[model samples]
Every structure is written in structure tokens, then in C-alpha cells.
Target: MKVLVTGGSGFIASWIRKELAARGHSVLVMDHQDRRQNLAPDEEFFLGDVRDATAVTEAAAHVDGIIHLAAVLGTQETISNPRPSAETNILGSLNVFEAAAQYGLPVVYAGVGNHAFRLVGTGCYTITKSAAEDLARMYNLYRDGGRITIVRPVNAYGPGQSIAKPYGTSKVRKILPALTCRALIGSPIEVYGDGTQISDCVYVEDVARAFVTALEHTAVNGPTEKPVEVGPLTSVTVNDIAAMVAGHAAAVTGRPVVDLVHLPMRPGEIPNAVVSSDTSTLQQIGMTAADFVPLAEGIRRTVDYYATQWLPGWLQGMQVSA
Candidate 1:
């Protein structure tokens, strides 16, 4: 199958592209940025914004299926600038769905698993993502012939996951990468609120594998309306995450354990104790939490990867507060 992956340059998409290539499928990446290093030999690139219908249509023209992963992610960015967030995440997703509908191609849409649990605060990111999910359902219903498979992913983290570059004045806040980077430099690991908030973090490679599984599973496009929830079943608290990173940093670089600093929680943040996903749906796709990389191992691998690949540049930028 020749697959078109939107936002193929992203962390998770890069892994997914490799997974597809390994399965002997040709991939065409459509992204605003070029990441030729992540592309396979048989893969092609189409440079454009997903918000443009013509661009999306042109990119999807020759693909057997579509995996829609493009979006302006992160809570800080979405809340700080709601307009562009809505325009890109919501409208941009509409363009993808519309183009897929036009070409009668099957689409696999990525969603947030946090929406399945109780939410707190303003939820600007959730609002736009939820809107996009609704639009996908609408397209599936109205278009009558198109197949749209939705996969709700939990906190995905691993190597290659970096903080989004600063957008103007607001600094990007991604949990794992931030903690790991700070711990490596012996800086205090900042935990928002009481540091009790829990996340069901999944390894990037596992999440990427789930995307490919969903794309191949026929039941994903069946009569079910619920999106497949994919992630590690074990939940780890923010404090636990900080401790894990500190331990790994200490072991790797002979650094002392980093201190955990409590900070005020941001708006739209929720205290998640545990994550409950549809196990039946996951089993259907031949995945389970047991298939995930262990938390400690994943953290160590991430720290090592960043230490060699990203730590120097990150240290240069470390003068900025978390």
C-alpha cells in the first residue's frame, strides 16, 4: 500500500513512517517542513499546509490511504493563541477529511486519550482536538463511502521527543523531555501543581506501531463509533517521573539526584490518577500495555539519546526557566 502521512516530520510520525516502510508499504509525506532524514528510500514528500484543501487533495491523489497527524500541539501554545490553534487543528483537519472524502481514501485520524477521562480547566487544546474528531465522524457519516479510523493516544514519549521551539514569549512545556533535560544538568525538576497528576505514557515506537496496526485492521472502520485507545496501562505520577529521570541521570552521568520543585499548575490541567482504555479494542489490533517499553528503560534510553543528540543544544538554552 502507498500511504500518505500528514505531519510525517513529527516525532511520532517519523517512527510511523519507518514502521510502514518496514512493512513494505510506500509512504508519501505531506508536511510544511522537510525531514528527508526520516524518509525511506521509496518514500516521497509533498510540502504544504494541511489547512489548504488543494494542497491536501494534491498530496492524497496517489496514496492508497491517509494517516492524518498534522496539528499545532501543546497546551500552552493552544491556550495562548486559540485562533491559530483552531484554524490549524480544526480547519486543517477538515481539509484532510474533505480531501480524503473527495478521493474516497481511508483515513486514520489521531486523537487525545485524555478526553476519555475527566477533564479540568479551560481545555483549549481539547476543544480544538474534539472538534476535529467530530469533523472526522461527520465526514465519515456524510461522505457515506469514506472510511475514517480514529485512534486516541495517551502521553507518548521516547527518544526524539523534544520541546517545541519557543513561539514568541510562551515557552513550550512537554513533560518528559523537559524533566530529562533538567535532570541531566543537575537543575531542579519542576512539577506543576502538587506533582500528583498521573499520565499513561506510551513509548513513541509503540504508539507508532499502534497507528500502523489501526491502519491495517479492518474493524477500525467497522460500525463502532468509539476510537481505539492505545497506550501503556500503567500510570505514573509527575513526581514518580521526576524521580525516574533523576535516577537515570545519576546513573548515566554520575550526577547527584535532582530536586523536585513544586510550581503552580497551569490552566486546563487535570489530575489524572489512572487511565482506562478499551482493552478489547486494543486486543483486536494485537497490542497491549505489556508490549510497551518499561518506564525505567524508556526513560534511560531517552536520557541517553538526548545526552548524545540533544543535550548540548538543550544546555545552551537551559538558562531559560521551566
Candidate 2:
């Protein structure tokens, strides 16, 4: 299989590229970002944006399928100025689908779980992604030879996550675990409102694997068959995840973590958001959500990754006090 992974240099897409290449498939990594260290030697790399239909079409000319992962992320980034958000996510997705249709290639869209449910905040991102998902379904129904699969990922996290980055709605769920670790390490952990909001977190590796499975199981003949949802189906609360993060940190540091309550809930925050995916399709296709990495273990691994790979620069940039 020859696969094209957009935004291949990003946190999740990078892993997807590696996974595809490891499975004996040829991969073409396309991204506008100047992040070269993420690609493998075998990947045909192209520095490009998805918003350009001509570029996308040219890139899709020879690929068997596409893993569409490029999008304007970060709720704050998107909602602040909808023009850029609309142009990148919505328009970018259309280009991918149109190019797929033109070249008769299968497509598996990487839609965000944060946008899967209605929320009070992050309107910009949710709006564009919602539009994108609708386009995916539309392509499935109308486009000939265009198989469209949608994977709604709930709070994917693991190594390569930057704690210092913006906490957009897609990233807010991460606050629980991040603050928990802070507390365990005797640092102040902030919480918005009473920290009772409910959500779910999955590992990035699991999400990346789901994309691969969907691409492999794509129906070449029937474009309307929606491949069943893949990845974790369990839900956890913000408080629950926070406590778990603190527990693991305590175990690692040999000290009790601190809980620091902070400002009120952000405007438009969802009180409770959970996902109920029918995993029968994914399982029948020989993929298991249980293969999804456990959140607790994933948190520990993520923390270790930050410490080893990014802690020095993070501490220096953030000015963590002793």
C-alpha cells in the first residue's frame, strides 16, 4: 500500500507515518511545517499545505489511500479568528476529499473527538471539524470509488505532547493528568471550577493504529459503508484522571502530590462529554480497542518522555521554581 499522511510531522501524524512505514507500506509525508526530524528515510517527504487543492491533487496522484490529519488545531487559535480556521480545517478537508475523488483514492479522516459532541466552548474548531465530518459522510454517499472513514479520537495523549503548549478544548482534558503529576511532584496543580467535568483520554499510539486498521479495511467497492469507530470506548472524569496522575507521580517521586484549586471554569466549557462508540466493526475487522493503551500507564510514559526529551527546555522556558 502506498499511503499519504498529511501533517506527518505533527504529534500524532508522525507516529502514524512510522507505523505505516513499519508495516511494509510506502509512505509519503506531506506538511508545511519545517519539521524534518519526524520522518523516516523511506518516506517521500513533501513540504506542502492541504489548503492548496492543486498541490494536494498532485500528491495524491499515485497514493493508494490518504490519512487526512492536517487541520488547524487549538481551540484558542481557531475560535479567536474563524477565517484561518475555516480556511484550513474546512477548506483543507474539502481539498483532500476532492483530490481523493479526482484520483479515486480511499480516505480515512482524523476527526477530533472534542468536536464529536456539543460543547459550550471551542466553537471554532468544533464548527470546522463538524463540517469536515459531514463532508466525509457526503463523499461516502456520493463520490464514486471514494471510501471515507471517520475516527473520532477522544483526548489522545502520550510522548511528544508539550505541556507548555496552549490548552485548547481538544487539549483541556489533558489538564487533569498534567496537574495531577504536578501535585505528586509537590508542585501546585490548578483546577477550573470544581473539577467535576467528565471526559475521556486515549493514547496517541492507539489512535494512530486505528487509522491504519481503517485504511487497511477500507472497502474498495462500496464507498458508503462506514467503517466502525476504532479506539478507547471508556470514559473518565477530570477529577478521576487528576487523582490517577497524582497517584502515579507520588509512586515515582516518593511524595504526596499537592492539589491547587484555581480560577472558575472557562466560558462555554462542557460539564460532561463522553463517547459511546460501537466497536463491533473494528473488532470484526481484527482490531481491538483493548489494544488501546491504559490511561494510567500512558500518563506515566508521557511524563517520562517529557522528563527525558523535553524537560530541560520546558523548565527553562516556563521558569519552574525550586
Candidate 3:
């Protein structure tokens, strides 16, 4: 299968591209970011944004299906100024849907796991994603010769996280990267409202598999009812995440990983939110929590990545401080 992965250069999409290639799928990427070094040499990349309907349609013209992952993702940031996010998340999605419907292409849409937060109005991200999700279902009802699959991922973490992505809008100080960065630099890890808010962290690799499953199972003749929710059954507090990052870094590098400090929850953010997803679809497809990488193990790998990527600068700084 030839697939078009929007936002293909981002973290999760990187894994998706790899998964697709492993399964012998040809990949075409459409994103605002430049090509990264890790992409398969055979993968074709287009420098474009989903917001432009012409560009999206052009990219969709030659692909068999679409794995839509493009969006502006930030909790507080989206809530602060929602127009760009709205335009991208909502409008961009509309473009993908329209193109897929016209070309009769299946789409494995990457939605947000926190979509349940729509009830409490966490931010524009939830609102826009929820809206797009509804559109997916609606489009499925009448879309000709195509299907749409929605995969709601919680916190996807692994190696290669950085601030170059603006906290990675595709991120703003996304929790895992933010914590790992601060820990690497011996900077204080900020905890919001005692760090009790719950989060479900899934490995990027697992998330990628879930997407491929949806794509592989998609019926070319029509719409299928697959709203895959990828998350672990267990939960972890934000504080627990911070502690693990700090503890693991200290153990691995024999360096002071830094301390956690409490702060008020930022505006437009949900507080004390314990989120667990409905993995029924993923289970139906033979994917479950058992297959998920252990959170601690995933964190260890992520910390190792950041450490390796930034160790040189960190060592130079440490020498200066000493």
C-alpha cells in the first residue's frame, strides 16, 4: 500500500513511516517541516502544509491512503491563541477528509487521547480534534470507496525529542521531553498543582503499530468502524513521571538529575485529570496493554536519548560549573 503520512516528520509519524516501510508500504510525506535525516531513502517528502487545500489535494493525488497526523498540539498554548490551531487542526483535517473522499482513500487519523477532556473544555486542541473526529464519522457514513480510522494516542514518548519543534506545536514543552531536558541540564522539573494529574504514556513504537493495524485492516471498498484508542491500562501521575526521569538519569549518568518544584496549573489546562482510554478497538485487533512498553522502561530509553543527544553540551557546562 502506498500511504501519505501528514506531519510525517514529527516524532510519532517518524515511527509510523518506519512501520509502514517495514510492512512494504510506499510512503509520501506532506509537512511544513523540512526532511529529517532518519527517513527511509525511498520515502518521498513534500514540503507543504495541510492548511493549503491545493497542496493537500496535490499530495493526496498519488497516494493509496492517508495517515493524517498534522495538527497544532499544545494545551495551554492552543487555549491562549486558537486561530492558527483551529485553522490547522480543523481546517487542515477538513482538507484531508475532502481529498480522501474525492480520491476514495482510507485515512488513519491521529487524534488526541485527551479528547474526553472536551467535556471540561481543556483547550482548543480537544475542541478542534473532537470536531474533526465527528467529521470523520460523518464522512464515513457517506464517503465513497474509502474508510477513516481514528487513533487517539495519549502521551507518546521515546528517543529523539527536542525543542527544535517548538517543544517538539506537533508541541509546547511536552511533558516527557520537557522533564528530560530539565533533568539533563540539572534544571528544576516543574510540577503543576502537586503533579497529581494523571497521564497515560505509550511508547512511540506501539502507537505506530496501532496505526499500521488500522491501515492494514482498512477496507478499500468502504468505511470501517475503527476508532483505535492507544493507551496503557495503568495510569501514572505527572509527579511519578518526573521522579522516574530524575531517578533514571541519576542512575545512568551518575549526575544530579534535579529536583521537582510545585507550581500552579497553567491556564486552559485540566487539573487532577485521570485519563484512561477505551482500548476495545485496539483489543479487537489483538493489541492490548500487555504489548505496551513499560512506562519506566520507555522513560529510561527517552532519558538516554536526550542524554546522548545533549551530553556533550551538558559535560561542558558541568565542567564550567565545577
Top-lDDT structure, candidate number: 3
How big is the positional error of residue 234 in model 2, measured in Å on the Cα after superposition? Answer: 2.9
lDDT at residue 25 of model 3 (Cα atoms): 93
Expressed as tens digits, the lDDT of each residue in 1-322 for candidate 3 is: 8899999988789899889999999999888978756567899988899999999999999999999999898778888899988999999999999998888888888888888888876889789988999989988886664478888888888886555342332347677887877777677887888788898788899999998877777744343465788988788788988999999888767877679999888876677887667766686556787778889889988888878876666677669989
| Model 1 poorest 10 in a row by lDDT | 162-171
How many clashes (backbone atoms < 3 Å, residues ≥3 apart in a chain or on different chains) does model 1 have? 0
Ranking by TM-score: 3, 1, 2
Which ten-residue region of model 3 has the weakest summed lDDT? 162-171
Per-residue lDDT tens digits for candidate 1, residues 1-322, read: 7899999888889899989988888899989876776666777989899988889989888888888899887776677788877888899999888887787787888987776432445456768887888888887777765578888888788987756433112255677888877787788888887877776677788888888888877324542356878776676687888899888888877888889999887766755445445545677666786877888888888989878777776666656654
RMSD of 2: 3.3
Clash statistics: count for each candidate: 0, 4, 0
Model 1 spans > 4 angstroms off? 35-38, 116-120, 164-171, 219-225, 271-276, 312-322
lDDT of each: 0.78, 0.72, 0.82
Q: Answer with 1 or 2, whichever has the higher TM-score.
A: 1
Better of 2 and 3 by lDDT: 3
